[model samples]
Target: MNKSAYIKLVNGSAQTEITLAEVKKLFEHYQHMTSLTGQQLGWDYKAAAFPYTMEEKEQGGIPYLLLNGNQTQLYHYLIVGVSQEEETGLHYIQIVLPEQATHGDLAKANEFCKYLAKRLKGELHLFNGRIIYYNPRK
Candidate 1:
């Protein structure tokens, strides 16, 4: 199941805000903690992999992550920005899996989403609108 997942940081009353610093910190942590290498399949293509290092880039002042590949072309990325919703205006971060993403990519995305939500005091919103990483005890 190749799908996207969002990590949204909400303030009191679900107001959206830009949390660039925190998001950057989270990205840095992800980079430090993960080390995955793609498998060699053939001369032209490689197996979809995970834990890829993402580079920070900005377009129109919005920050996003680009999966870094040494020899292969990659399209997977993570975007960090504010949500467009008027009522919930919240800081939104998302992991966009490439269309060719494999099961490993999906698992990694889910794992990272959970980690990010816990660390940033955020919540994971799946593409289907299902929420995760919420601690009912808290």
Candidate 2:
């Protein structure tokens, strides 16, 4: 079966649903940008794929991506960070997926986060999941 998920872009007290395809395309852009940076700084051009986790905060606006990966649960991580909303200041955004995800799945997730970050002109981190990003500043 084709995997499906719901993603929300957190931007300053506002959230919106974004399509998975858009997220994947965004990842492609991020990869290209990272590749350029790697060449300029003599760094590796490969990105790592890591596992992650997502959960709703007891009292929260959006969800949180917490890093919880280990030897036994090698595929556990969080995709949490601040993003801009409506051209305003930064806001928190969180994305979660099921455990034991595939590389393709992680790629899509990374793509989505990278896409949103670029759109908001903000920085992002893997938190717990393994990612070989060549710096988001580029």
Candidate 3:
């Protein structure tokens, strides 16, 4: 089984989906671009096994291309899973850690999740099921 974390929007029923390019840009902005690759999804990413890839995946009936490869710390690939339709405010994006994830990976993932949530000004659901709000300070 794989471990996972989530960065959900606090503003309920606001957005539709989180885009991968946005996540990649965030990684680049935060100097964490090394966390994910620009390789094509389902092709170069898995075969390379290079820890992470920025490739977007098109899931069944999904309207948006999944974003961000887990340092931006996914061992294989990162997917943006949507559990709802248009108004997927919460549960918008999930960081599904690869099965090969370890304690160090989890730690890094948590930190990454925190950073993302804080930057996005949303809520973070940790792997342990703890919810932390990332509202702007002040």
Candidate 4:
């Protein structure tokens, strides 16, 4: 069984800010795409309660969420984070699975990652370090 999976999107040479507006749209689109309601998901932060809706939270920061369990069950959430290359400081958006994630969970995460990678016009890198999606020059 695979322990985890990842979808990483690189932002090229420039480091661009991931705006709240973009995240909000992504969340909305995700909800629409998956037909997932508030009860089905939650932010990773403890102060944030379950049955939480994205509309209820203020936008403007990188946010992570759990699919069906609380924080202690790390394997159930969607992680959104930024990684910077040491030499150039170029940023990449990463969506990764928790340590105990199952194949079904990974499938869900990958679906969302595919949508985000297309929307962001970034590369989709799998946990195995393969570039799965990228725009080719015309």
Candidate 5:
């Protein structure tokens, strides 16, 4: 089986600073995505507890989330897709799975994304830019 995963940005101190409710929402969102995707695809989805981070440079600082995961291929997709920062904060919360997933698996992933986008009341960004289904070249 091909491994596949999803990713997004959660609560952070970038704009207004992170809050309890925001943090709770982030976790809840992750759980929802994981459960939904797992149920549909028959794969175990894991959540990364560590928040994405970036090292501050001595001069101008560039912030980033240093996410590490078991699936290296999916890791790249997750980092690029869900780690986007808006003017105030992140675009969406991120979740990731294995890269050994199939097309049907990704279809199910999209469903979870749509569900999250609706729940978060925000736009769901996928495939690093395009608004279509995620079809990264393997």
Candidate 6:
């Protein structure tokens, strides 16, 4: 099974929705943040061509952005899928980790997940099924 994490948009939050372009931009921001540190993730995200495609609703498909890893860099590819719940219409941004992801990669993923959760003010569901609330405390 593929390891994955999720950012669930809570109702009444400042940001309860996200666009594909925004998701791409967030990933770009993440890549930049990683590069700003002393160590880079060794992935050329700009050239990787994260594609966005929408399928017909009748076909039971949803819009999604796929970010592929750089094979030349020996990096394992991860996937991000955006989906909305049918009943509540809440959105979820899912980050799927590849099975071959290294320990460093896993740590980086967690960092990214936390960064996203904080930015979106949403709850983050970790790969291990633990949920983290990033919203401000009342």
- Best of the candidates, lDDT: 6
Measured with C-alpha atoms, the lDDT of residue 20 in candidate 5 is: 29
Ranking by TM-score: 6, 1, 3, 4, 2, 5
Tell me the TM-score of each prediction against the true structure: 0.61, 0.34, 0.58, 0.56, 0.34, 0.69
Clashing pairs in 6: none
Best candidate according to TM-score:
6
For model 6, give the 10-residue run with minimal summed lDDT: 50-59
Off by over 4 Å in 1: 11-16, 31-50, 59-61, 69-84, 133-138
Candidate 2 lands at a TM-score of 0.34
lDDT tens readout by residue for model 2, 1-138: 123222223333123444334444444566577678778778755243222223323226643344444323334443443333566443434455555554555565666666665564434554354433322332
Q: Residue 132 deviation, candidate 4, in Å?
A: 2.3
Summarize candidate 5's per-residue lDDT along 70-130 as a digit string, tens digits: 3443333222123345675554444333464444435545555565544444444553344
By lDDT rank, best first, the candidates go 6, 1, 3, 4, 2, 5
Our model 1 lands, by Cα RMSD against the true structure, at 6.9
Tens-digit per-residue lDDT, 1-138, candidate 6: 369899988954449888766877887776566455524555654343322222212224655554444452444555667788899899988877777765544665677688888889898999889999987656
Of 2 and 4, which scores higher on TM-score? 4
lDDT of 3 at 78: 39
lDDT of each: 0.57, 0.44, 0.57, 0.51, 0.41, 0.67
lDDT of 4 by residue, 1-138 (tens): 333343333444122456435555676666564444434554332223221243322237544443453433333554555555577654466655666665555665666666766676666676656666554434
Q: Taking the tens digit of each residue's C-alpha lDDT, what string does model 3 give over 91-121?
A: 4557776666555556556766777777777
Model 6: residues >4 Å from true position, as ranges? Answer: 34-63, 71-74
Write the number of the candidate with greater TM-score, choosing between 1 and 2. 1
With a 3 Å backbone cut-off (N, CA, C), the pairs that clash in candidate 2 are 27-111, 48-132, 52-77, 53-77
Q: Report the Cα lDDT for candidate 5.
A: 0.41
